[model samples]
Target: MLTALKLTAFGVVDESTLELGPGLTALTGETGAGKTMIVSGLGHLLGARADAGIVRRGAPRAVVEGRWEVGDGIAGRVREFGGDVDDGELVTLRQVSAQGRSRAVVGGAGVPVSTLADLVGEFATIHGQSGQIRLSNPDRQRELLDEHARPAELARYRADFAERRAAAHELAELESEAMARAREADMLRFGLDEIAAVDPLPGEDDALAAEQAKLMDLDELRELAAAAHEALSGNENDYDAMGVVGLTGTARKSMTRLSDRDEAAAPLTARATELAMLAADLAADVAGYIDDLVADPLRLEAVSGRRAALATLTRKYGATVDEVLAWAASGAARLAELDGSDSRIFELRDRIAGLDSSLAADAAAISAARHRAAGELAAAVKTELAALAMPHAELRFDVSDAQLGPHGADRIELLFSANPGSEPAPLGKVASGGELSRVRLALEVVLATGGEGHTFVFDEVDAGVGGAVGLEIGRRLQRLAEKSQVIVVTHLAQVAAFADAHFVVAKASDGQVTTSGVRSLTHDERAAELARMMGGESDSDSGLSHARDLLARAGRG
Candidate 1:
């Protein structure tokens, strides 16, 4: 429920504050007294488009603010917008500049105007002449029916529809790229097969290159080994020049003889024996190395050929055998994915088929629920219409199958007939402006039952309606206010007479600026305002008497 509204520099309302209560509140004034500005201010507060032209002369900007009694339904949304709901109230503020810039604030947090719109249904529902026009829309009709009929089931069906839509979208993309994916898979397969045939091992390229270098210089290596062996031990033909091994042995014999002569010589003898052993070992190793040096051209060619093969792989896949192996591993995994594309496609197709079946079932259930609800809603509206001075009026819901959509597979339309024994026609085609207003009101009274705490604003809901019908409209609004806060802007005395609280918007001019001010009327003041609305002077005795009668009839006297 909206507790209050304030407007500054908005329309002809330079500055005004309306303190509201939780029941039917009526805004009444003479024509052109800016009564509708109250509704306009509320619209702007609820995120309607702001017009710079509405800004009052000499005012730089226009601002509209509202205070609402917060409920659990809107607390989460307020929190989602980074708003604070301390003290169980939410203050929403909107400002529009003459330069065409607009800003919104909810619960003291600045937000986009769209955030306010997102909270519309949960917070309030604005019904006016424009709303009546919207009621003729088939989509709007379907929405109202769903809102009253099967909200929970419709929610479930919509959720499933969203998931199914996403799956179908993915399937379409995969199918469209089928040819490209197939080509990619084939390329990966070929690369994998080629790498497998090579059978490259980690570090094999570097090892092969080292071996090939050694084999290519085999002759030089063998000559060097033979020279080292001859130097370490005496050559077979050059025995005159003793090698290190023979000379070391001669020195060892002398050291052994000296050690026997003196104890000090024993340490020198041990050192000489160690030196002789080291020389012998070195000589034997050199000899073995020379004997093992055998050069085979065929082996060299084999090593070179293997190195070239590895180089080919390195050129295409990686700079090293290890890297090439890594690529092969990764490629094999990707190839597996590509290979399973067909199976994945089949899986998605099967899933889509299953979803289609599920959607059909859910849509059927939703339609059935709507059918049941349509009958009840139509009958109820007819009853409401009968009370609103249209006893012979009939309302029918035309529920038919439509293509599956986000909401459901149902096309709903509201049909109406003004007289008995007449076939009901589409609401937009047959209903007059007056009939449309009443129909809109009837729907509101019916729907308002489900919206317990919502604030309902009706701007000229009595348009094109008056007399007994206007009285009935007032009564219906008063009844709706029993469960929801209803604020109406009217020029009809009949409707204003039924208000729990009456506010009169009066215009004042100081020759330079005209301003509209709103003030709650006292009992006598309300009668006088109603007298003015009845096209009579407020001071007329007869008008006052009639006004009193009107209020007494509505139980507000």
Candidate 2:
């Protein structure tokens, strides 16, 4: 519930402090009497966008502040906004500078405008003549019906719907994955075929290259080996002294003859003979080795073909036979896994189908709940309308299936039939401004009794209404005050007649400077004001008497 409101240099208001109570409080003045400015002030306090031009002329800034008795969710939200609040004593202040910068404060701490907006939103909702006209939007109409429904059933329906949506999303991604892997499966098969045909053994390509080199230069290699062997071993040459063993024998005999006088010649001769014998043995082995070096083209061609196949595999997979084999092993394993994935996907799809079917049932159940709630809502609104003097008007909630949204599967629209047999259209289409005001009044009446918000304020709900209809609007507003706080800004005397509290806004100036201020009008004062609204001059006997009579009839005893 709101405790107080203060405005300074805001719109047409120069300085005003309105002390409000728990019941319905009404504001009434003539057109251009700044009644709308009071609504704008409340909006500003609730974190609406501000323009510096709204400040009174020659004023530096516009200010609007409000104090609330936090109830229900408001206290929690106030603390969330960094205000330590107990029992809903929250002070929200907003100031807009002429330079276009605006500031907001909660509990004396400067805070962001959004913070204040969030806190105030928990306490009240401002349904303006333009934005967020409660009955004008289809979605809000649906939400109202849902709020009035069975809470446990709505919760179950919401949970089922969420599961259905999650399953649907998962099914979509799984199907996409299957398609992507199909391409991969083909590529893997192709690679495996190309590699399997090669049948490469590790290091086989290098071994083949060495074997081919040996076969290609077989004759040249054999010739070089034979020459080297011949140089090392020769049987015919230098056996004794130079030609063979005979020459070495002659040298040894000579050396032996000299050995009688000097022994060095005999040792030299024996060593020379041993070296000549080794050369002859090597020459014989060389002749044998040359015979084995003959070329075999058939074996050579086989080696070349084997090497080519290994090389192909190396180029396709990796630089070596081992790498190609590793790639084949991995690709085969993954392809097996991918093939098995299709079964799992099918299982998920089946499960998702089951959930989807269940979700529709759950949604239908929720829709059924709404239908029951809508009937109750219609009855309640009709009761409110009777109190509002539109006894013939019938309000109905048309509950039907709409597009699946975050909320649920049902769409509820508020329909009205002002007369019999006329097809009931939506609330916005059939109701006039005066009728709309009363309709809004009836809605507030219902929501108030339900204990929705801490405070409810109606601006210009008397737009096109007067007389008994206007008085009934006032009476209903006053009745709503019994539950929660209510505020109304109007020009209708009948509405003004039922105010638990009355405020009058008048433009006053001392020549050069002009300003607007508000004060609560007393009972005698209210009569004069009501009479003035009853089409009589202020202070006239007829006007004063009528104002008194109107209050008396409203049963303000």
Candidate 3:
């Protein structure tokens, strides 16, 4: 239930605060006094989008705040949204800026706008002459029927359904992979076998290729080595031309002779001696390597075979030994899966069969319970309709099979017969606007009875009614308020006359500016307002007398 509302710079409402109460309350004013602004403010507080044009003329920003008292009825839900309420007392508020930014707060802590809307929704419903379109939406209708059928059971069923759906989805993905795998299974096995026979190791390809090139050029290498050795140190190429070491020794002896006369000659002599020693070491190495450089065909064959094995692995699996090894591991896993595909699929079918049996039983139980509830609900609605001046009308609840879903195959339709001897038809195709309002009100009254949390507001439900009918509508609204809180926006004097608290929405002009306002009326003052609604001027005697009589009767309730 809403405790209070505070508005500033919102629409034509400059600044105002309204403290609400527990029983029938009415708001009435002349045309264009901004009675609808209150509803618009409530809509904004509910997280509904608003137009910036609704801001006041001189104000830079608009704000509308509502404080709702949520006691034991929805405390758990409120706490779940990051708000704590005592017993069921929850305070929720919304603030909007002129720049189009909005904020929602619950229990003085900030929360998401959607959270605020969801939490506030559990408390009040804003039903106007247009009715609730969201409720009529196909998806919303499906949810309402499901809720009406089995709330807790449906909740658990949905949880299980999600898991089963996820498992089925996973099976589909695996099946697709398995299909592609099936076509390549033979090729994969053959290629893997070939690579295994090759048995290439990391870096083995480079080593083998280097060895093969060396073996292929062995003859040229031998000829070049012998010729190079002869040129540098052998007698064949060194007959008149001194070998490098012999020449260096001669140069060193000549420098030693000149060293006594020149300091630079000593360093030259030292360098010449160092060159002779290096020539000696090189000649020794050349002689030693000559026999070791022989090409061994057996070893060469082994190197070539290793190189070929590396080539095979690279071609079959990947560009490298490590990549081929990884493919081998994944192939092992996939082969195992392929071997067990049939068995796994059978397992899933068996599980699904068991689930189907259990779900069938659960659904049947739910259907049986719903059949009983529908009968009781229909009888109750018919009784309320009779009190609303439709004694001859009848209501029916038809539950039938729907699609296979978590909710267990139930579709419901409301059947209505508005006249004697008339065949009952579905509510959607047959009920008129006025009839719908009465029916909605009757349902609200019936369902909300003895339930937790109530702040009911009906806006102009008496639009197309008058006399006894209008009075009965007001009477029922008041009767409902006895169990909870009720507020009404009406043009009917009978309706206004029933309000324990009456607010007259009046327009005032302060020189150049005109503004709408609201003021709670006293008993005598409320009589004048009701008289005005009865199509009488403020001072009319008969209107005052009638308003007094109506108020007196409503006060007794």
Candidate 4:
């Protein structure tokens, strides 16, 4: 519940502090006395959008602060933002600079403005003139009925409805693009067939290239090997000409004779013996190479042809054999999906059909609930109307069959008849302004039943109403306040007479500036204010008499 509200440099309100408490509190004033500014300030404190124009003409910024007696839920949320809550109390502040910059603070810690908006709904509900206008909308009527009737069931129905709609849309799109998808499938299949015909293995392209290179240089390779072996050993057919083996053997004999005279020559003899054995091996290898060397042009041609086939795949698919293989794998997966689209279309049709059948049943069930709840809600509103000085008014929640939609398969309309013998018609066409005000109030009172220990603020709820209707509106607000805190901004003295706490917003001018301030009224002061609100001078003897009579009638004289 809101405990207090303070406004500084806001609108015509230069500085004002309104101390509030439980039960009905009324703020009343003359026209343009800034009664609505209080509600506007309250809105700012609850994270409404900022407007630099709301700042007083000479002030740089406008500030609004509210103190609340909160619960552990709100306290825990405040702590989540590293804020402190003293006992059960929390303070919220909003500031708007003349440059349109805004800031919000909750429990002394800075927070996003939306944070206050999210948390405010847990403790307060504000109804303003816009709410009255919204009541005439049929969609808003259906929403209100659903909120009161079966919120959980309707939520489930809406979820299924959304899923069914999505599936239907997907099915339609798939059917519409059937030709395009077929073309895509054909292109993919051609690619896949070309790849399959090549039957290229991973790394096969590189292996073929290496084998082809070796085959292309076969003659040169054989010649190079023969020459290298010859350099290491002379021709074996000319052994008498003394190849390296014969020469090294002769040198070893000389070194062996020298080693007999000197030990240092022994190492030279071992090296010469190793050189002679290597020379003998090399001469045998060179003779084998001369015998093994042969040219086969047919094998080389076949190798080159295979390399060309693999090259074709590499050019079309990837830069390498491995990459081409990867493309084939990826294309196969994509082709599978493309080929499966027809089956998926069938699956979607079945899915959408199943969901539609289920949603039909759900919508029927929701309509049934609305019908049942309609009777209860109408009866409740009728009772509230009777208390609000409309003893003969009839309000009906007309639920009729309609096409299935997000809300349900029922059309909800609020029908009203202000006279006893009149037939009820749609509320928008049949209700007068005053009747609408009373009816709107009645619905609010009925729907607001379970909001105990919370705060309800009403701005201009008594608009287009006066006399006994105003009195009854005041009475109902008082009754509502019995369970929850109620605050009303009104021009009706009859309504102001019923408040447990009354504050008068008065505008004053010092020749150059106009400012509004709110002051709590004493019993005597309340009478004077009420008299002034009743269109009579405060000091008039007759007005004072009537004001006192009104207060006494409210049991507060």
Model 3 per-residue lDDT at 128 = 67
**Count of backbone collisions within predicted model 4:** 0
lDDT of 1 by residue, 1-557 (tens): 88889999999999999999999999988788898899889888777897899888889999998888887758878988799887888888999999989999988889889987677556787887789888989989998898788655677778878988888888898889889988988888888788888898899998998888888887999888887777778777977978888989999999999989888999989999999999999999988887777878898889888888888889999999999999999988987887787788898889878878888888998899899999999999999999999999999999999999998898888899999999999999999999998998899889888777789999988888899999999998898889889999997999999999999998999998889999999999999999999999898999999999999999998
| Selected candidate, larger TM-score, 3 vs 4 | 4
For 258-286, candidate 4 gives per-residue lDDT tens digits of 99999988998899888888888877887
Evaluate residue 71 in candidate 4 and report its C-alpha lDDT on the 0 to 100 scale.
93
lDDT agreement of model 3 with the native? 0.73
Which one wins on TM-score?
A: 4
TM-score of 1: 0.79
Question: For candidate 2, which ten residues in a row score worst on lDDT?
Answer: 240-249
lDDT agreement with native, every candidate: 0.89, 0.77, 0.73, 0.88
Q: What are the per-residue Cα lDDT tens digits for candidate 2 across 1-557?
A: 78889998888788899898787788887768788888888888778887888878888898988888776456665566576665558788999998868999887778898888877766676655763266679877877777677545566656766776786786677687887889999999999998887777777777888889999999889879865754554334545324333444455667657766777676765676565565456555776778778789999999998888887878888788888899999999989988977876787778777866766677777778888888887898898888777778898898777875556677778888887787888888888877777777677677657664467878877777777787777777777778777888878888887888898888777897767788899888888888887889979988887788888878752
Give the 10-residue window scoring lowest on summed lDDT in candidate 3: 132-141
Cα-based TM-score, every candidate: 0.79, 0.65, 0.76, 0.82
For model 2, the superposed segments whose C-alpha errors exceed 4 Å read 50-61, 71-73, 86-88, 97-104, 108-115, 131-134, 155-358, 509-514
Candidates 1 and 4 compared by lDDT, better number: 1
Candidate 3 lDDT by residue in tens digits, 251-278? 7788878886898788888887788888
For candidate 3, what's the RMSD?
Answer: 5.4
Q: Native-vs-model 1 lDDT?
A: 0.89
